[model samples]
Target: MKKILLPALLLIVLALAACGNKQEEPAKEDTPSKEQGTSDTITYQSEEGPVEVPANPQRVVVLSSFAGTVHEFGVNLVGAESWSKDNPSFDSFLKDVEEVSDENIEKIIELEPDLIIGLNTIKNIDKLKEIAPTVTYTYGKVDYLTQQIEIGKLLNKEKEATEWVDAFKARAQQAGEDIKAKIGKDSTVSVIEEFDKQIYVFGDNWGRGTEILYQEMKLAMPEKVKEMTKKDGYYALSAEVLPEFAGDYIILSKSDTGDNSFLETETYKNIPAVKNDQVYQVNTAEFSFNDAYTLDNQLDFFIKSFLGTK
Candidate 1:
């Protein structure tokens, strides 16, 4: 009788343990899978609409102005447009990046990019989309910093972009305050670029550090530049009237190949800013874009040029 009772108790304990194990098995199955946590694609709310892109893009190709922004985000850039590749500041970073364009479908296809970025004005949109997840931005649709934030969203690096924008704005505004103190509260600045034998003056939103100087730094824009560039964001005029656009300080963005014979002219040399030695000359290649990398470089240049500090 004792042997039979002990065997029955043992069987009951073994059965209870089996039931407990079965209950825990379903809980494990109900939990999320590793594959579900790491999806290959994520939907991005682009300017055009929602488009699916790689969650962690390993290969990216930029066909327009966002190369610096993308590169600054630390994404792998397999290809970029000629302008970005030719930028002297980007030389070391883009040394291995292939030079591509909107028209080069075969070359782009060979790169096997998982993501492609460009302006809305690019050609062969449908063809590019067929090859990879393609996203395009309309120029000036958003402010430069906002554009960087948007790129960060696209790259899943919004936090980093937002941090950069906040820090940069503060730095630029402080620089502006320091410069204004040194120069004067009423001192005005003008951004002038020489391209294609034509001279142009820019407003706040235009590239060429105009955004940094007028928008971020809160520097005064010459009234003539404000009036002329108010309509087009930039105004083209002859070098003879360059003095009319001159200000207390001038940011001269010059292209290496552009005809800059005007710089040697008496009219240019005689301008108040030039004569006062307030003209800050920057290469168009280095100063053209408002991307983070370029903007930082521009800020450094301004600090060194204005306050004479590194």
Candidate 2:
């Protein structure tokens, strides 16, 4: 009876030791079960409504003016609109990017873009949405800087976009101060573009560096331009009235293809800015948009053009 009791006690001790060892062992991590799902998309609150977009967009197509802004965010652009493609400043980066338009549904389909951006005016919106998450913006719905921030939110790069915007504003302000010191505090500036056989002057928000010239830099706009373009943001006039809109300094944006004969006429040639060689000519395609890339370029151009410093 004693031997049987000892054997029973020993067996109990061994069992208790085994339990302690098991308890001390590290737990195996839980593996995902078949019922679990990993979502690779996020909901973006676009102007139209809430839409699901890839959390990390691999291929993107831009069908409007935001190409440069998107490109500045380090996004991979597979296709872009003709205007963006035609921009000489974008040539190096967009060399491999295909030129696409709102009308090119079949072509865009072939690109298999995970994202599509365009203006609200684009046709085939529904079809584009079927192909991928499509986001559109109504022009002038927001200020130029806010527009960039909006795109940053859409792309999940708001932090980066905000950083850029802040830094840019500071730099532009400094540049403006430097320019004012050199050109005088009250010297006025104007932005004019020649297109479709007509001459147009722009307000502060209009592209072609108007934002930098008037808004960011706080430079004075010619009273005539301010009066006419105050409501429309831009005004079209015959070449005869060009002098009325002329300022101490002029930024002339002209397309090589447009009828630029007006620039040769005495009416335009006699403008104070032109006669004083204060006119800085830029390509319409290059200076047309207020995107990050274009804005940086525009700012640099202004610094160099005004101060003769790179």
Write down the TM-score of every candidate: 0.87, 0.86
Tell me model 2's lDDT, rounded to 2 decimals. 0.75
**CA displacement after TM-score superposition, residue 24 of candidate 2 (Å):** 62
Displacement of residue 264 (Cα, Å) in model 1 is 1.3
Tens-place lDDT per residue, model 1, 1-310, is 1110110000011000000010022233322111212377777777666788887888999876677778788899999977677678988779999999889999999999999987666789999999999987665555667777878878877788889889988999999999999999899999887766778777776567777888778889999988887765677899999999999999998777889999999999999899999999988776777678788888999988999985
Encode model 2's per-residue lDDT on 136-197: one tens digit a residue.
Answer: 77655556677677788777777889899999999999999999999999999988877667
TM-score of 2: 0.86
Q: Model 1 — which ten-residue stretch has the worst lDDT?
A: 9-18
Model 1: per-residue Cα lDDT at residue 184: 94
